[model samples]
Target: MPSVTTPPADSLLQHRAFVAFWFARIASGFGFQMLSVAVGWQIYAVTGRAFDLGLIGLVQFVPSLLLALPAGHVADQFERRRIVLLGQVVEWIAIALLTGMSLAHGIHEVGILLLVCVIGIAKAFEFPALQSMLPALVPAAILPRAMAVSASAGQAAMIMGPALGGFLYVAGPGVVYSVCGALYLVSVALMGRLHYEQAPPKREPATLRTLFAGVHFIRARKDVLGVISLDLFAVLLGGATALLPIFARDILHTGPWGLGLLRAAPAVGALLMSVWLARHSLQQRVGTIMFAAVAGFGVATLVFAVSTTLWLSLAALFALGAFDMVSMVIRGALVQLETPDDMRGRVSAVNAIFINTSNQLGEFESGMLAAWVGAVSATVIGGIGTLAVVGLWMGMFPTLRQRQRLHVEAAAPADTR
Candidate 1:
């Protein structure tokens, strides 16, 4: 008699909840990318100062940092889906205001900064709840695969959203803003349909202890601490995106089209890698794989820093993105699986803090360093720093370095090692 193989696991798309979540992500992601482009272009058109443009990032980052803990608490204490909905509603309203302002020719630096700040606050609340919602959307067995598929949605939006916004901007920025509002409306509708079932959280006082629970939990969980920190330092040091404009203009001797290709290359690589991962889940040696990927990311950054031609730089950026995706999938799955339901919101908030801060800081770091040394030299330094981080983390996080699989249970017994 032939041995029987169990039926294949159900596709994540078949699940109504995950499907709704995935579509919501795509719509929202697209809207956000489009909004960002329009806002930056309009702001520059209104005010020629590059200093004001820097203010956009400053306002966004400050609110996220200040509100992250409270947002996590809110996510933990309330219904996540409802919180996400309310946050998106705030964002939708903000987009509408942007549309109205742009149409009426009332848009200005102050108003744009203020509205962007509002969106930042909403995101602070939305992110923790949103990130924590994923584990409950699918089976534990296929969570990693689901994460990959979900990530692909963001990558797709990143690849096309700006282009779509740019194309629409040919009419007027108001037109782009109008389209973003429409996309956001679609996102809100999909999120309204998302199915989420979580037990009501116990009412707890908002104390330092309560708010900081996620941080404490991470410190106690060596594997989690390692993974999260590994990602933080790796991104903080290895990121070379800030130098792309310089590369395209000065080094590669190309125009805006070349700059656009350079910007899209990473997302293109990440999207293709995610599609592949969605089809083929990792079965073993996940810890080593994640570290190796990070190392590869560093190497790719080094190559991108050195390459003078557009195509070579694009290839290197593409490799950087592919490697980053592998590690990201592993890190996301590990954090989701190892964490309990109650702690997920806070933990995810902490994770978001690391991610958001690193990205902002990485850009700042690159810019400042480039001001002192030069763009190419700065990127070279970042790549070297990233590799150093990987080596240091491996020695410090033996358990994480030795992790063999994605399952929480598999990681538990060897966690102390």
Candidate 2:
């Protein structure tokens, strides 16, 4: 195996393409986070139903579930920057339409959901391309740190975006949508300026075999499969954030601003953790570290589920974000290191499927359960499920649990032996 390369003293921000990409992520992420807050609040406010909030997640998830494979194939066969640019352009248009509709006072629940679907379709393509582009933007040795630094940008957006959205929502949902459109516009322009050496396209026909290549690659790599599936199940059940608006409005007796704070709490913790990760990479027993982080996440979710006070809930959410970031960074770097460059788009697509399922679909599950039982009960169950998954996964993937390092010089699981 080749010796593990150390990152240089030069800052990751020194790379112009990465800087451009970083800014793009921040701008888009800010818009998306704010949009999410506004949408969740507006939908629940209009309908006075928790199930509608879940529907918001379900509508967005449908497009990704259907298009994920094709989207991955598209990313591998086209210019990544262009694909990302086009997707953002579509998202910007959808936001603009939402802005116009809200300004007209004609926004209906159905219309909002339909537009969210459009944005989801665009995101379905954007995610894989954007994810695959990162390793190409910096030296492979420093990609982990670059990822951490880039993630900090997203965390910062989430922290500010929700609060800002809640504040702007006081003016009107129209105001929030307009601001989201502007941010997306900025993101599109930055993506347009992003430049890197062109890697030749894979230029493969769109057969089922090509579309599912990422699936095949992951199945062949047990550690990679274990890491991703662990994240998937952990997050899928612990998606208690879907019930935040309910807690804020009904239980906590807070307004949109309170909901915004609730949303931003996690980001605050994530941002702090990302900064720490940027400075210090996990060097040994990384597998144990990842599992511990997930365990922490489960515990924090339980705390939030039971907490009645605002401050306690916020504290729990903060801890949840911090724990999740540790696991996320470890999982991201490990998967990227284990996959070949040519297969990254497909693998990332598969990874995105897991992420979207755990996020969007999880929101649906939370909403349904919350309606059937109660928000607190639903969240408590999710937290417990997450804890159960950890134990099951630890038993199922002994190699992952026992692994010592993040970097693997070879892609195959057998190579380490």
Candidate 3:
């Protein structure tokens, strides 16, 4: 295994393409966060139902599951920059429509739901394109650093976006959507500045056949499938994010600000950990670290479920988020290091589908369970399930645990390797 080295924080900043990509991601992520908060608050405020919030996740996940494969194929075949721009354009349009409805004071629950679906469709395309384009911007040696920096910026935006969205909605319901639209436009402009070395299209046909090839690639590699499956189940069972509003309103007895904090706490923790890991590279013990982190997440979630105080709840969420980031870093590094350069886009797309399904399914499960058994039980049960996932993955996929440092040197393109 080749030794992994930490790049200077300024490496990505020095590259124009990377800078542009990072800026665009930050802006878009911020806007998306704000939009999510607004939608949740609006829907709950109107319907007075926890299940309504779950539907939001369902809408987003459905499109991602349905379109992500084709989007990945397109990302592989088309110029990545162009695919990114087109997705951004669609996002901007969706936001614009939402803004117009808000300004007209004609915003209805149904209208907002439709808008949410439109945003979901945009995301279905945007995510794969963005992930695929990363390798084109930075050297293989510095990709981890770039990813860390990007994740930090996105998390920071998440911290501000929700709180700001809640406050702005109080001032005027239209503020959130308007800001979201403007951010989308800015993202489009930022993406315009990126450059890519164009590659000829793959000889493989763009159909279900090619899409399944990505699945085959994962199945063929034990290590890759192991990492992916671990995350899939862990996130599927452990994700209690969508039910935060109920905890905020009923259990914590805090309002929108508390809700925002609850949502942001995990990302804030993740951001801090990501920064530390990026600065001091975690080359060896990658698998062990990921397992420990996920287990930590389960423990944190368990504590949060039982906590009565807002501060305790916040702390638990923070811990969960931080550990979750560790898992994300390890799994992401695994994917980047293991995947062939030619199939990165499709493989990422397939991964996206699994992740999306798990996340949305988790939200649905939490909501239904909460409705059936009560909120506290729902969270506790989910946490227990997450712990079980961790144990099972560890026992089942020894390759992930047995494997040591990433073969970064071997991952390089032929001549470089």
Candidate 4:
């Protein structure tokens, strides 16, 4: 066998395949972020209903919940690049539909919600393929640095996409959707440049046993289950981003531009932290740091919930992102390093389910709660709930709490079983 040498951390950018994949992430991230801002603004502008805002999250959540297992199976069986390309094609078509609706001056709440569901279905299929592709692209020794770089690029796009969306929205929703569609096309071109040779998959007949493999894999590992579940419930309770439109219009007394700034603030903080982590790896006391960071995220949410001043609220959001970034990096590294290659697609699908539940379902939960109580009161209560979850998880998962490093010895296939 030919010898394999690990690439130096600083030299990750020199690899052409990784660089292509990175740009693809940048394009897709920016388009999706911009599309989100446009959809939220358009929906709220037309209906002026908080329930409809929550409905947007619900519509998107349905496809992911329904298709996650099947999608994971497909990723393992097929060429991942083709799966991603097909998803982009679906996304492009959805964007085209939105743009046409915008141009016709017939943008309806139901139409926007339906298109978002279509996009969500496409995302459900694409996520596992994209996530599992990373480990194959870079050597294990530099995986942490590569992940940090990818996240930073994503954060940078998040910061730019919303602000650009807001600026273009002044012209009309048509402009924003048009720009988003163009970006999706650019992403397709970038994705085509990637060259990944997938290993032959283990041959197994379709069965219930094979489908549930990812769940069983996660359940057997206490550390993976602890971190994944911790993030799931914590973010489910603490999510406040779903209410930004209300905050911007009613509480903060700001317009679309202000809403854009509010959305971008968290990414700004995350981007800065990602850059730092890329330079300095979190090699020690990772579990302890992750726990503390989550607790801090809860406190920051509380501060944001009660703040009356814009500057103070922005500061609170920045702090919230900074803390969340630390937890994200640690959890992400653990997920990538601990799973066996053959099971990566399935495992990543499980992770995606946890994340989507926290984000989209959490948005629905926030909206429903905000409608019951006032938005401010709902947020304050959710933050407290997050803190409560942290305390409970720490007590329950002592092994996870005691974990000292991000690195884990690769388990034998039989050991995973």
TM-score of each: 0.95, 0.86, 0.87, 0.86
List runs of model 4 lying over 4 Å from the truth: 1-9, 39-55, 97-114, 169-175, 243-260, 367-377, 411-417
Which candidate gets the maximum lDDT versus the true structure? 1
lDDT of 4 by residue, 1-417 (tens): 111233455677777888888888888899898999899999999999989987887787888888888888888878888899999989999999999989999889989998999999999999998888988887665666678788998899888887788889999999999998998898899888788878987867657777789999999988899999999998999899889889989999999888877887888888988887777766678889889989999999999999888898899899888888888888877887788777878888989899987987688899999999989998998899999999999999888898876664442224432
What does the lDDT read for residue 171 in candidate 1? 94
lDDT for residue 256 in candidate 3, whole number 0-100: 89
Best by TM-score: 1
Error of 3 at 140 (Å): 2.1
Model 3 clashing residue pairs (backbone):
none
Give lDDT: candidate 1, residue 296: 97
TM-score for candidate 3, residues paired by index: 0.87
As for candidate 1, its clashing pairs are none
lDDT of 1 by residue, 34-138 (tens): 998888898999999999888998888998999999898888888999999999999989989998988898888899999999999999999999998998897
In model 2, the runs with Cα more than 4 Å from the true position are: 1-5, 8-10, 37-56, 99-113, 169-175, 244-260, 306-310, 364-381, 410-417
Off by over 4 Å in 3: 1-4, 39-56, 105-112, 242-260, 370-378, 407-417
Tens-digit lDDT track for model 2 on 346-404? Answer: 89999988987788668879999999999999999999999999999999999999998
lDDT of 3 by residue, 78-149 (tens): 777888788888878877887787788777788888888987887888787788777667776666666777
Worst 10 residues of 4 by lDDT: 1-10
